[model samples]
Target: MMMKTIKYASLFRSEAKKVHRSKRWKPIFNEPLPIEVTGSTQYQGLAPFDFVVALLQDGQSLPSYFYVHPLTLPRKTRANIARALNKSVNEVQCLELHFDGHNGDHLLVYSSDDDANILYLIAIGTHSDIFG
Candidate 1:
């Protein structure tokens, strides 16, 4: 597997550090949302995905939950993204992906559940699963 770079927001890094220091999972899970994807995310750059990949790509399995400010991505055709993620679009925000150790993963390709295909871009992972 190609190793993608992981760039963490300062706030998230700090929060992670604090959580580590606190010696607990609840604290980490309770952390406020991470930075909003702005200028960088506008270009369809893989940065957002890369960040998530970096966060959980190690041999160990760690679940991560993220929130994205919704963006309408009609231009982001399902076919193209499916080709990229190597998965098929199940519904508006649902797609199937097989990521090495992470199986049965669904990409809320864009977070909004509405019909406009608004991509609120978020990846969720829990104790038994990962959504990156």
Candidate 2:
């Protein structure tokens, strides 16, 4: 009998860790935008990364050839987020970070459901995190 391939979600745990360590800077804006944090996919439980990428790309309507997912994020750091999505890092107080999409870009979006524990991203940037 042939066996089927099972996708284990465990491998992603480490990738997820990389995101958390990254610092989420406060947006330059004086006020916080009306955004929420979540763990559910914003796109009806489908892939929500695209929506996030759109917002990150200055809210472009066109589709992209790549898939972006959020591995981790801190609170209220949306301004420099564009750089993080691109898998590049920003420096402040001598710190660099990466967005671990498990080999894909990352985005932040809102989820309709409300039972999630982790925060949700509505966009991504060109930043990558390393050693913190």
Candidate 3:
């Protein structure tokens, strides 16, 4: 069965709680590169979906970086993103991350229950390429 996509705001809240409670942010290497997760809110960009920045770390003092949340994108777009990242669609969906071939930022893409044809894309990187 397909996993139900929760609200973008709700997911952000849950991730914040998890990060604060566990204080752990593990980086997952997406083949040939390391994708760091951060909770910093200093990112400035316009996204297609509602998103928030959250830090990922093991403690309060050391913050590796920040990651954006609640990215719901379309399947075709997802596929294109997956290919760009040298990843499979399932990997992209399961991990909530995508590499735009530049910079270091954690990106998220989630499906929308209200609109099956739409997928939310959230990230803390420059939106000139994607949004343009």
Give the deviation of candidate 2 from the true structure as CA RMSD: 16.0
lDDT of the candidates, in the order given: 0.33, 0.29, 0.34
Off by over 4 Å in 3: 1-67, 93-132
Candidate 1 minimal-lDDT segment of 10 residues: 104-113
Query: Candidate 3: minimum summed lDDT over ten consecutive residues — where?
Result: 53-62
Q: Residues 50-130, candidate 2, lDDT per residue (tens digit)?
A: 333323333322123333323443533432332333222332111111222335334223211112222223322333322
Sorted by TM-score (best first), the order is 3, 1, 2
- Superposed by TM-score, candidate 3 places the C-alpha of residue 49 at a distance from the truth, in angstroms, of 18
Compared with the true structure, the alpha-carbon lDDT of candidate 1 equals: 0.33
Model 1 stretches astray by more than 4 angstroms: 26-132
Error in Å for residue 117 of model 3: 30
Candidate 1 RMSD to the real structure? 14.8
- lDDT tens per residue, model 1, 1-132: 333323332333444444344433432233322334222332223333343343334222222333322333344554444443444554434322222124323222222222232222333323233321
